[model samples]
Target: MRDMKRIGNDRVTSIGLGTWGIGGKEFPDYSHDREAIEALRYGIELGINLIDTAEFYGAGHSEELVGEAIKPFDRDELFIVSKIWPTHFGYDSAIKAAKASAKRLGTYIDLYLLHWPGDSFEKIKQTLHALEDLVDEGIIRYIGVSNFDLELLRRSQEVMRRYEIVVNQVKYSLMDRTPEETGLLEYMKKEGMTLMAYTPLEKGILARNKCLEEIGKKYGKTAAQVALNYLIWEDNVVAIPKAIRKEHVKENAGAMGWRLSKEDRERARLCV
Candidate 1:
């Protein structure tokens, strides 16, 4: 709740709940439906309004869990993001996927993204056109893409002249710095797009880093919190770390409301 990043007209917490595992048996570690629901609800109760899910996740089970977990909250208060699978990249299939995801989420999607680049430019063009149409029809508020490199992102923007691509979700963590190394982070900032960092914890590796732990001691936070804070400390970036346990959710929330010094941020970058 402390670091709020704006996506289009919506302002959401820099720290969001990711539902990749909550999708069900597809992820062996997240088979507990009840715990997943409880953790999501607990996150929202703590003012975490950004929830990221996808139709491909558990073949739509993740959206269903998100739908159930968000039932008690005002729909307008949350920013729900979902994605269309790469195989569904086309005018018709993309539209169908968006509608199906919305139905499962039990609300209009705040932002819908193309999960990845298609095999052909024509295919990508068709999918972007469909997303533009969905925005026109009010099925989705904004359009975006994920796992795109610099050229694909540029091409996607050129193809969709009607609406701006507001976000680019990718795997970025202390361990995986490819986005920054390849200048994708700089390009995104230049184009006014939010870099939605998925797997910001590197699947728990950075959570146990000795460098992050040392940095966290100064802030009275955990290494995981320090690692997460490093991601959201910037203005044009947001980190969505998945947590299916109440205790983990609380720890994730603790990453907010504090700032890391410039030296420490640089140290983290070098250490990782």
Candidate 2:
């Protein structure tokens, strides 16, 4: 693992493990708890100390699995993040939901984010304010928003100034360049906010791309590694690629350290 960056007072890994697939029943297939726990432990063994999960994933079963996986490790060595569902918008629900997630996670959540902007803008505002209150109460160290666009990002920024938002989790990958198109990346960079890339592998689509395969072989890397390297190379960008197998977990961690050359990066960008 690399040195953790300061997000507010909390430190975060540049590369994290997205536990959505392993923990959630919404994916390609519902995996067993034992398998998910193995994957999480394998990810930690491979030096991935950041774990991203949500309360809605299997209705809190995901957090339970994450808690068990990291049980043996020193708590400070890991940065655990979880999300509150949009339905829990007001201060009362936000506080209650966060506590439930924390209990299921087996430790204080290092960072907690609003999963999505709910039904109306008013509810979003109320929810954000509630999250900020959680920070003051020592429940969550940092607050963030997910799946928000440029405009919403700016509005959230206005409210988050009270508590200092440190990250924005969004779907970003070689295959999906919507963040780049919508200026979310630039905006986050300008605000000194980390953009956590979920679905960083495009659910393995980039791994099978012919261009990535050819480029990867030249550098003794896998196509998926090539894709991950591209995301981590950008400033303030971090990728959390979900992997169920140990070999794939090791492969994803290989994305650290070395970076693609400027020409190769541009080529990969074009391909993506």
Candidate 3:
């Protein structure tokens, strides 16, 4: 597996396996159950220990597949992260959702998160509290939030300060530049919170960016590698780029062995 990073007290692979394609409703479903299991098995062979999914992905079909795929591997070597949907915001729903996710995953989740910051702040707070209780009860190792803005992050942190909230899952990439503009990157880095970069390849848009192409040519890398490297080299940031192809999986992992110089960083920042 690629080198791991410490999120609070837990160790996770730097380049995680984004499970959306294998499990997402919008993406092509696996041709058959074996394809999904084989893809996950391939990811493990490549040292991708972190598999990111949500209860919403295939309505839990993804986690079920993940569980089945990783059954032969040592559970401790994998960093499994799954999310709870926003509709399940109240304490009861939050608790129930966590149990359901755990049941479907067939293993304890390494991290659980609030999928989004929906309308009810009180319900969100109750859900965070319930997650904290789960951690205490040894049901989950860490708790976090996703798709939250600065104000929501501040609000969530107020509740989570007493607990162990280590990461925030968000859409971040060279093509989607909002996270940089909104000051969430700075806030997250300073708070000792890891930024789990979902859609870090911009849903495949960065591969078409001219700026990325130019940078990739300079480094002799693909546009996707350049975009992913931009996030991987930044402090306190990790990305989960989905890939089922062996060549693409290795291409994603290849971004890890180099340092983006100050000039490269400046060029990438200009694109953002």
Candidate 4:
């Protein structure tokens, strides 16, 4: 397996498979269903055991694909994550959405999340309480939120005094360093919360960057590999780059089991 990061008591792979583009109709160009399934299974074979999906992605098509791809693998060895959309932020709706997601995933969700912040604090609190109930009911092992800024993350934590937020899935990449600038990454490091970077490659841009290419050449790796290596170099962070091709899955797996030198890491930071 690749290096693992602790999210509460659960140990998950530092690199996971993101299913955004595999959600079929949502990303038509990249939605080759058979190839998507093959890529996901190939990723698992390479020891990338964390799989992230959401009910919002293609109205649950992503979860369906995840369920199919992971069928032959040992379920206990995989860490499955899914999310409930913002429209379902209330207690009852959140519960319903979670159950539906679990059904689509064909397994208990290791981690469930609120896809985004609600309009009101009360609504967020209600949703958290509902997620906690799901945890108690054995439907979800942990709860988290996504797309939350520092204030929203803090508020969500404040509401759940008894439970911990396991992750915050957001757009973080070599090209986009907003988390670092906003102090969110520092805060998460202090709190021991996992920051699951959703777009570690910046939609394939960083993979083709000259700076990353130069860095990768020293290590005999590709720019994409270097970019992914830099993202998960920290203990508290993990990166999930979506791949629907078999070769791309193998390329992503190559990002693990290596370290970027301090100088190259700095160059990657400065060059971007």
Candidate 5:
């Protein structure tokens, strides 16, 4: 198994799969459907249990492909995450969206997040409450929010009446440390929330990062692996870099199962 991290009581692989471009980005692209499904299965073969997808990704085609890919695996063993887009930010719309996403996934979503901050705080509160209701209905297991800043994250948490927000998926990478720089990372750690690092490779640019490559050489690892290791080093963080290519999926799977020295971890701050 790959290294694991905790989100409340649920455990997920530190190196989870992000399926943003697998089926398509904003629309459906079936050109690489076979390769995409194969890559997802390969990641599972390599012990990746956490898979992140959203209704906005590939216009919900990503969830369909994920549903098809994990058909043979035990559902209980896989941690599936999906998000509700802003279009469905209202109470009823949020519930409908979660049900729709779960239908596409062909299984109950293990974790459901608000894709982005709603346009109104009232709308966000309604969405958060809807997510909690999903948990009550057993359509979703955990609740989370994505792209929420520190201040908004606090208020969102306050909106929750039954369950706790267990994760905040954000764009975090060696090249982008806004979460860390803004103290959001620290506060989440203190609150025992997981900071799911999306774009951990900076859209594959970090795979070729000179600083990470140089540092990885000493550990017999790739720049991408080194970069992902840096994010998971926090224990409460998991890096989700999207890759539909089999080689890249395998490479990402190798990111964990080892440790980076504290000195080397700090040196990554000077990424270039």
Candidate 6:
């Protein structure tokens, strides 16, 4: 196994699993349910410990599938991350949503995140308080936010009383370097927060890139592996690329466990 990254007090696979389309998207789709479950179990067996999912995904069915996938594994060895949607942001609804997600997963979530910044700061405050409550109640182990900008991250932090905001899951990849351009990545690093990079492959554009492929040739890796490697090159960053196929999961797991030289990393930065 590669050296896992640190999220608060827990260790996570540098290349974690992202389950957005596995069970479904906004609505439920069971066309590939068996394959999805097998893919998830395969990833876990290959040493990918962190699994990120959301309540909005599959309209709660993703959580259900996730709950089913991990039944045979030791729950304590895995780090599960689930997010509550905007509709569930409030003192009451947040707690309710957490319980619902916990029930679906058949285990307490390791990291519970607000799906988005949402509409109201007041509501965000209420949700944070409720998350702190959930922590005491043993519903969630850590609190985090997704798709949050620097300002929103600071605001969320201000309202946090008991637990630290440990992760900010956002779109980050060599193809889209907006986080670096906006200094959001730097700020998160300065504050000791993890920058969870979603869509790290740019929706498969990097899967067959000429530039990344050239770099991969030198290291005997695929273009996707090169791209995912560049994302986690930073100590504070972790890349979560969704892969339903067994081959893709195995390829993604290969992204970690090795380091790219300084010059090659700079070359990757200029790939896109």
The lDDT values for all models are: 0.90, 0.83, 0.83, 0.89, 0.91, 0.91
Candidate 2: segments with Cα more than 4 A from true spot: 1-6, 26-31
Local accuracy of candidate 4 as per-residue lDDT tens digits, 14-128: 8999998576665665447778888899999999999999998877888988999999999999999998888888999999999999999889999998888868879889999
**How many Å off is the CA of 188 in candidate 3?**
1.1
- Give the range where candidate 1 is weakest over 10 consecutive residues by summed lDDT: 22-31
Question: Candidate 4: where is the Cα deviation over 4 Å?
Answer: 26-31
**Candidate 2 lDDT tens digits, 1-272:** 56355566666666788888565675434557778789889888877888999998888888998999999999888888899899888878888999899999888888898898877887778778888888888778888889988898888778754877788899999889888998999988888888999998888899888898878887898889899888888778888887767788888888876778888888898776
TM-scores, in order shown? Answer: 0.97, 0.94, 0.92, 0.96, 0.97, 0.98
| Model 5 agreement with the true structure over 1-272: per-residue lDDT tens digits | 56999977878899998998778863354888888889899999899999999998888899999999999999999999999999899999999999999999999999999889968999999988988888999999999999999999999988789999999999998888999999999999999999999999988788988889999999999999999999999978998888888899989988989989999999987885
Predicted structure 3: lDDT: 0.83
- Kindly report which residue stretches of model 5 are placed more than 4 angstroms away from their true locations once superposed: 26-28
Candidates 1 and 6 compared by lDDT, better number: 6
> Residue-wise lDDT of candidate 1 within 49-165, one digit each (tens)?
999999988889999999999999999999999999989988999999999999998899999998878688899899989999999999999999999998889988998868999
Task: After the best TM-score superposition of candidate 3, give how far the Cα of residue 243 lies from its true spot, in angstroms.
Answer: 2.0
- Could you tell which candidate, 1 or 2, scores higher by lDDT? 1
Clash count of each predicted structure: 0, 0, 1, 0, 0, 0
lDDT, residue 244, candidate 3: 63
Model 6 Cα lDDT, one tens digit per residue, 1-272: 66588999998999998999778762255888888889899999999898998998888888888899999999999999999999889999999999999998999999999998889999999999999999999999999999998888998899888789999999999988989999999999999999999999988999989998999999999999999999888999999899888999999999989988999999988888
Cα lDDT tens digits, model 3, 81-107, are 999998998888988999899999899
Candidate 1: give the clashing pairs. Answer: none
Deviation from native of the Cα of residue 41 in model 1, angstroms: 0.5
